[model samples]
Target chain A: MKPKRTGKPEAAAVDRDHALHLLRAMTRIRRLEEKCAELYSAMKIRGFLHLYDGQEAVAVGVMQALTPEDAVVATYREHAHALIRGVSAGSILAEMYGKQEGCSRGRGGSMHLFDQETRFYGGNAIVGGGLPIAVGLALADKMQGRVRVTCCFFGEGAVAEGEFHESLNLAVLWQVPVLFVCENNLYAMGTALEFEHAVTDIARKAACYDLPSTAVDGMDVLAVETAAARAVAAVRAGEGPQFLECRTYRFRAHSMYDAELYRSKDEVRQWKKRGPIATFTQKMKRRGRLADADVKAIEGEVAREIEGAVAFAEACTWEPVEDATRFVYSEGRMP
Target chain B: MIDGEQALRTITYREAVREALREALQKDERVFLMGEDVGRYGGCFAVSKGLLEAFGPERIRDTPLSESGFVGAGIGAALGGMRPIVEVMTVNFSLLCADQIINNAAVYLYMSGGQFNVPLVIRLATGGGRQLAAQHSRSLEGWYAHIPGIKILSPATVEDARGMLWTALQDPDPVLIFENSGLYNMEATLGADAGPVDIHQARVRRAGRDISIITYSASLYKALEAAETLAKEGIEAEVIDLRTLRPLDERTFLESVARTHRALIVDEGWRSGGISAEIASRIMEGAFYELDAPVARLCSQEAPMPYAKHMEDAVLPQAAGIVDLVRHMVNAHG
Candidate 1:
């Protein structure tokens, strides 16, 4: 077999086993998301389904760098991160289907996936909203004399928000242990980065706050993982927050109903060819790490997991409407 | 938990409110304060004075000028298992965090179908005084009181300020605590005599038969002053302070209107769609036939408060405004 072109030379020494684990993580997310897209189209799921079809590498790569204790806060596009964090694929799919056994107790549908045991805090829908939260979580951890990093994932369009700027400055000013991850899929809803920001180079925006940050080939899982690991380590060592701009593209529209008039078909097709799942699989196969059966086995397992989630959801019940106001306060109700 | 005789305490309103914040912090480890100047500066009105030293920085956090940041963070912290107390300098600064309060905190509980709870207590210095001007000197507690998911509270008396914080903190959902700036320095004695106040109930400061004056916060003082003057003229006025604004204590107001046969609402907020307006409309909607006369209201002029001391005072609902309105109602009766 012809040697695969290495777009990243430093990524060569990541070891085949770790590379294979990354491959498996991406495979699990990819197959799960594919099923989600189908279920959404088939009307098995009701509300908005912001599929992670094109953004798999960012979740698998970045999450792979963290210990389970560190907290994660992500926007509505959070399925990949939740799956990578070890929330069962069945549970996530069931949550999408609005099941009683769902992680959020069938209350938070797709945009809100929280697992207290896992420290995966959300599916926060408000743009640029999670930055402040991630800062506060890091603030709490820092005050507790505990060394932990909080990873906040947002979109490039979030840069246009004041919360993005305010939270970034506060995170650096307070020396909070937080990693600001920007999954720049070129567009925030319908607005493109170039059209929205005067300074489209998002990593440079972090420079204004004197925080160390970088831009990575978001298409490569190893690249995101390596950058995230170094960034997370620096944050935990009390060097303060680091920002990473994962320059990636989304293959599908932003939401279930977007006409996708924002970008050209060729651009999406070009990005899809560099899909993180297949790219990692091909690399691992060339290294004799991943068997064809291994890939099939992972896919088959993820599908079964998703199927179980659907069954769970189909068996679940809506929270009683009279109890709609139940969890507005914590001690007010029991989980 | 409230004993009746212990309610009439000689404590000043400021000390009472401080008591509330103190008791709330001590009662729950989850209760913490976050806002600009809440810690080191000890709050603009000094309500949080001595709190930073007493509670320490971890609990009494001094945040940046980022109202939206800290308020949103408070919402996050509430979701994260801590009962967060977020203080906005005023309702004006509160608008900065409105997206978090109104959009995220207020609606998340319902929108998530009761899956998420924002166990947050937001304290704000509201109402106009001391010549702060157009931007800083507006009362918008009514806007918050209108929201469904969260509870709104305005502590007009020392007892309410001191006692309301405990009840607000005890609540599982988000509670907005609005303290009138003008009332903080109004001294009252604090001792074992003063007891806990419930956040749900309304109290009548003065009992009368001629008419009822329902109000909250700074306007309650004006109403009481007016009631005292009305008593001198033999026009007995019943004054009810709507300590809790959201759940409203509407039954108290209805009972007052039902007995007194006429009602006057005095509010420091603007007249149009103000909280007082809501009370008056509810009376009109529910107990119209019981009225000896149409309900009346005295609210702030429908204009941004000016910077001059007299102008700002004139724009707000002062004791003079309440007294004059009551006199007019009496004269019309004659």
Candidate 2:
């Protein structure tokens, strides 16, 4: 269901702790991404910094429904996903900093963060590349009789890739449990949705492959979480593949390099008014689940955390150039 | 010359490969064979003819005509802790999934900072000689060998055909085994207990002192034939079969070149930027001082493989051409 743009977040059923947890999650992503932009500007990070600015609700809500056992494959614009999936903020920043202490050991910069401990598959840079990987991960789980879901996140742009069609078909054909999440942030690089997809409705495209799909208001944290929980439960129950099209928008440019000539300031300003963090914060305050002091405390705590992460990243050491060729093949193996 | 206790059986190369797949599936529960027509259709070239009935459908899977999808799924399966043997019908079709093989399977371990290892094996029929024409016929193993993160294996003999698959599956990284379509029907004697073989070294198929005929896959047989013809004329040529193309056993061939004082590379792939070119360059870099004459290569003609038999034959490197090249190198050097 489309979220009401004017009403308070339907918070009547949400308890205090859960409401605050969701608020903190969104706040953490927002603060972390804001810092990442500053770092990119300061030249502390380089090579295509895609901040997950206006879409915090999607990652925050979806992650709330996933277990640690589930695998996640996300796009290059995945700093928020990685952070929400429990990759330490320090490691994520260090990865962008190209440090050996980074989660990907500095080998993968911004677009290739990977953490085996979290079962996070990668920060895949190619559009539509992670769909097949997620299918295969779920295929392995199904073959081995493991009850787990593999959540894959991509942009609406990936809907145009053949791998998307092939993966959905294979997922249902083989009956693997994978949740395909399309973060429809409207623009793929500089191209608009209409310019890329003939059908702007991304969820309907998943229906073509007989996949059960839902289009949730990506700006509403509760909406995304509800849809994701249902989808994840069905996938875990071996209901084959499920797809969620999160209708969202990116407040920042597509990348640090983009001028965003395809979009306008007016449109960006309108989306910002519906920004996930602000709307959710205002709704919780209105419901009396939070106060001005609570928001202030949360902001202060998140700010300190971001500072600590930045400090950790700044102190991390560079990987020795001698080890540059190390991971090309696994170490301690005959190449 | 055989030991009385050990029994040997004669089998076709196709049977040997099937035996390897059957052994791998039986040995490891995590091992499965996946590709188009690998199940009910019994493989494109019938290499996996009876596997589906033997191992059942789960282990012997048949995928749709989505090369990139299945191949990427193979990479994902490998990451998720299963040893997958993905087969593309031929090297020509592998292009559709080159992104998966080169980008995903190959770079996963490295890009992930060694957190994940893709224990995946890709098997595909390579080379031309069946008049499958340009679209179906290709010898692009050399192009794959150019990639760093994966290993390339060309099984020219029955023993290698029977043994390489299991060894490749054991590798922590991805390995692409190129089974030349031309050699699938060749028959040879192999021990009944024949199992996994080393995939790291070049094997000396024939020993001599005059020249080193370096080749692999189906071209190895042609080089051996040329060596036999040259041996009859009193010019003994050592034949080196490069079983592993990527991490090439340059030491074996370099040592052979040092003793023989001359080298001639025979490959089915085109000469320009092919494995032959890499081997020649390596020889020049490693054993140039030991050579009595400059190294030479006999590769397929720089053109698309034709459908007609005579035109195809004219394009490929034949035994006669190898013999003539060896004769000229030996005679002129002497």
| DockQ for the candidates, in order | 0.37, 0.74
Score residue A237 of candidate 2 by CA lDDT: 80
Candidate 2 segments exceeding 4 Å error: A1-10, A333-335, B1-6
DockQ-based class of model 1: acceptable
Q: Which candidate is the best by TM-score?
A: 2
Model 2 chain A scores worst on lDDT over the 10 consecutive residues at: A1-10
Every candidate's chain B TM-score: 0.93, 0.98
Q: What is the TM-score of chain B in candidate 2?
A: 0.98
- B186-240 in candidate 1: lDDT tens per residue? 8765556454668888888899988889998888877888888878888899999
Q: Distance from true position, residue B141, model 1, in Å? A: 0.6
* Interface RMSD (Å) of candidate 1: 3.6
RMSD of each: 4.7, 2.3
Best model per DockQ: 2
Model 2, A85-186: lDDT tens digits are: 999999999999999999999999999999999999989988888898999999999999999999999999999999999999999899899999999999
